[model samples]
Target: MRRSGFLSLVLASALAVPSLACAADHVTGALKGTNGAVHGIVDVTGAPKGVLLRLQVQGLTPGWHGIHFHEKGSCAPPKFTSAGAHVHAATPVVHGLLNADANDAGDLPNLYVAADGTATVELYSTLVSLKGGNNLPALMDADGASVVIHAKPDDYQTQPIGGSGDRVACAVLH
Candidate 1:
């Protein structure tokens, strides 16, 4: 009886650990930019080393658009500055690459809209997390941030922030 009870307790503890870990591993949110008519959804899987963001978008202008994390997640008018600033986890502010060190935390690859004006993008960045050395603005702790769709592709290198044009739409991540 003692052996059976011990084994059962061990198994139960193992199962419980995984259930908690799985719950902590998942992060999700939505995207709403200036292009009010269309909206997108974002699902993020956070790992110890990196986080994968899978984005599905529709109702865009049908071309190259910048996808990034803005300063604030507020999605306010005239320039959603509330999302705060770019994430640029490793980007030191000199290198001009989305995955580079100087890049903002939100600097992601350019998103392409299909002829139908719909698009989907998947990206992974280690720059998101609370436990890791790298941390993104959008976490459960704060209001997080919004994923913004730019009117133009980010030029990759611009002063202060990327040359990504005005925000067409934004989605606030809770």
Candidate 2:
């Protein structure tokens, strides 16, 4: 109605646009297992170095579990073979956090579940990219990616999954 009120409204709408755009830069996944499910969210806004991953999972074994981003976004129940291997950016490397040469882009820290079989964790990854920059593999590629939870902890020194046991849970990221 008034010029001052119209200008204020315009300014407020303009300020809200960036936050709305940032919210669109996020991806979500629903991790499912035989017993329970987990909700995963990845925020790629302002990812100058990396992305932020937030996860809330239930019905675990109450111990350490290895987590990674699989190369494919297909999550088949039971085995999850459709999810493929861990994501690699440039070249094939060893699977370990302490490797001297290199580690898989999808390699991540262990997730610990409490006695109640619930875990809420936030993690950051600097290897892969959401916008597909710096020669890194994009999580939103043609094949996409999946977040996988293993049955055992990664020793960070062994080859090919670092002694991580069977795939317990998986969520295809879009």
Candidate 3:
């Protein structure tokens, strides 16, 4: 089978298998840019020990960009600061995916955009949940969470945003 077909089969299986005690197995939403444009779509599913994400987006700068799960689900345009910081525990809250003492569950790897200004990628996080469980924070909590895209790439070892620049696009995980 083609790669896309195979991936569809895999994703279908994943969506069907996991059963969370509360809430649906997954959540999906649209991505909007700071300029108030719809860029793409996002699908988030509850996985065995974590969460799975599949995203397809366009109109980027065609390079590496930082992506993360933010503390708040609000994606107020212009400046996504309303989304708050990374979704992290109250303690052990050091940033950077490469940090030894790292405890920020919202940290994710850099997302690469094609020369055509589009990106299609799958990511998994072993630190969060959909409706909140396993002592991990919930991406779909009372206030909710969001997937934010940055202007620059994440160094993965730097503090905070890793110089990822501005928050360009956001998708609230409702």
Candidate 4:
């Protein structure tokens, strides 16, 4: 019985070795608005399925807002257009996450802020990765990427940002 127990322990240790070798990578960035205020922080970590995101934000109008991963890491103030469009793979992707013919990899659920203008949430997406792998767009690619928070909520089925309106906050993750 002791020998059997030792063998089991050794087998378990061997199995854990591969997972340790493929440790999850991580990246983080500070979220800012057009006013240049550091209103929040965004932390991203790699996962076996994809990536996980944690956001803690404040100082907003206090309602539902659209959030997504953009194609570039640049976040010019006034308007975050410098961050570019949503991240996508080699194949052309449509805008809406709920659309039958579309569902871009960058589309994520809307974020909600309280009346006091504060929000803390964690989101996970299997469509993207922190590093380039399995044909997924790397959030930390050569050009890197940015997380954009829109002024309005995402309808999830509309075209061109789901009518989420202007880019109000951005976090560069290069």
Give candidate 3 misplaced runs (Cα > 4 Å): 1-23
Candidate 2 residues lying further than 4 Å off, grouped into runs, are: 35-46
lDDT of 1 by residue, 54-78 (tens): 8898777888887776545577754
Ranking 1 against 2 by lDDT, winner: 2
Q: Write the per-residue lDDT of candidate 4 for residues 59-124, one digit (tens) a residue.
A: 977999999999898999989999988888845668787788764878888999999999999999
Q: Which stretches of candidate 1 lie over 4 Å from their true place?
A: 1-17, 88-95, 98-103, 130-143
Return the top candidate by TM-score: 2
- Clashing residue pairs found in predicted model 3: none
Write out the backbone clash pairs for model 2.
none
Clashing pairs in 4: none
Each candidate's TM vs. the true structure? 0.74, 0.91, 0.85, 0.84
Backbone atom clashes (below 3 Å) for every candidate: 26, 0, 0, 0
* Model 4 misplaced regions, further than 4 Å: 1-24
Decreasing lDDT order of the candidates: 4, 3, 2, 1
Q: Name the candidate, 2 or 3, with the larger lDDT value.
A: 3
After superposition on all CA atoms, what RMSD does each candidate show versus the true structure? 4.1, 2.1, 8.2, 4.2
By lDDT, the better pick of 1 and 4 is 4
TM-score of 2: 0.91
